[model samples]
Target chain A: EADIYQTPRYLVIGTGKKITLECSQTMGHDKMYWYQQDPGMELHLIHYSYGVNSTEKGDLSSESTVSRIRTEHFPLTLESARPSHTSQYLCASSGTYNEQFFGPGTRLTVL
Target chain B: GESVGLHLPTLSVQEGDNSIINCAYSNSASDYFIWYKQESGKGPQFIIDIRSNMDKRQGQRVTVLLNKTVKHLSLQIAATQPGDSAVYFCAESRGFQKLVFGTGTRLLVSP
Candidate 1:
């Protein structure tokens, strides 16, 4: 099994509340990624990091921000969560080969 | 603006039969491809992957076929079981960049 893990598998909050989704991996992978997926839809890359202090925006524009202070941790934070952000947030880590191993995912619901 | 997509939204198969899921990618530059299986309320699990240099790769009871000429990818599962019911996604990446995921195909296996 993959060593990637995500906290708070489910979250529900009101609009405008700030929230942080935690992601961590024990595989010592340098590349970490965050993806947003809706029900019955494909995953869209929102953010990614290539080792410590190296972060980049993904193909999809997202309001959340990510920080990669440590090689194993890549957390995503939403300054002001909106109803539109109600979806599944998946965290993944990959090695040099680019085959990603995903976490269990955090399902967010902005009421 | 390139994208990956699936020809079928859903596929129904009988138990003990073979199942195939197809995907098409618009970017011919993609060099690596992977297949993921996502069960309900869980993260996507890495199933198998095939590099552009290879036309076919097999793992356990799963096989991945890549056809660069038509920009097509496929996953074949032998002896489909009820436990194999899930959403199957195909992802493509060029080099070490972020992956582009195709709209998943839901596999329904019935006894």
Candidate 2:
């Protein structure tokens, strides 16, 4: 089945540690996005990629960076994690203006 | 600075009852809108979508109503069930694939 996937569903790392969240989509979508969401709060876009080798920062300034090496893969990396960085990270992909499909999400906890 | 917001932060409804969630956007230029249902510890799932040219659209036991004049949107769930309990959010897209999401309304269904 064609779907989006995220690895490390839950992560607990110490502060200052480097961590990467992996996201992959099998639907061959060119547009991918990363969103940060606090528990029970609204999702805030952190990064997005329009196509291969393209990335942009979203409305909410983020300390993380993302890369799109392939159409199906978009990974986010935090050079130095902090406790404030602890939140759920969701990945999504879309083909056009239609609905977007989201990954299961990665819950990160920086202790 | 077009922001999307929800009318209610949370809603509680009995099982088998109808549930309604409302959203409002500040951008009239938005061309598309979507409703997403997100359960705890998971990502948002696409529920329904509506274009600016349309007023209403329906899906399995769900309906989405869009009003461009007032920049308002609504999602109605028929015969609400426990599985339907989640956070519902409305997203708006203008030209780019970037979707701006609303604050979200938590739906709690009681048996």
- Cα lDDT tens digits for candidate 1, A24-88: 99999999999988876778889999899999999889889999999999999999998888989
DockQ of 1: 0.43
Sequence-dependent TM-score of model 2: 0.94
Q: Which stretches of candidate 2 lie over 4 Å from their true place?
A: B1-8
Cα distance off (Å), candidate 2, residue A43:
0.1
Once superposed on the true structure, which residue ranges of model 1 sit more than 4 Å away at CA?
A: B1-8
Best by lDDT: 1
| Docking class for candidate 1 | acceptable
How many steric clashes between backbone atoms does each model show?
0, 0
Which 10 consecutive residues of model 1 chain B have the lowest summed lDDT? B1-10
Scored by CA lDDT, what does every candidate get? 0.91, 0.90
Candidate 1 per-residue lDDT over residues B2-86, each given as its tens digit: 2322243889999999999999987999999999999988889999999899999999999999999999999999999999999
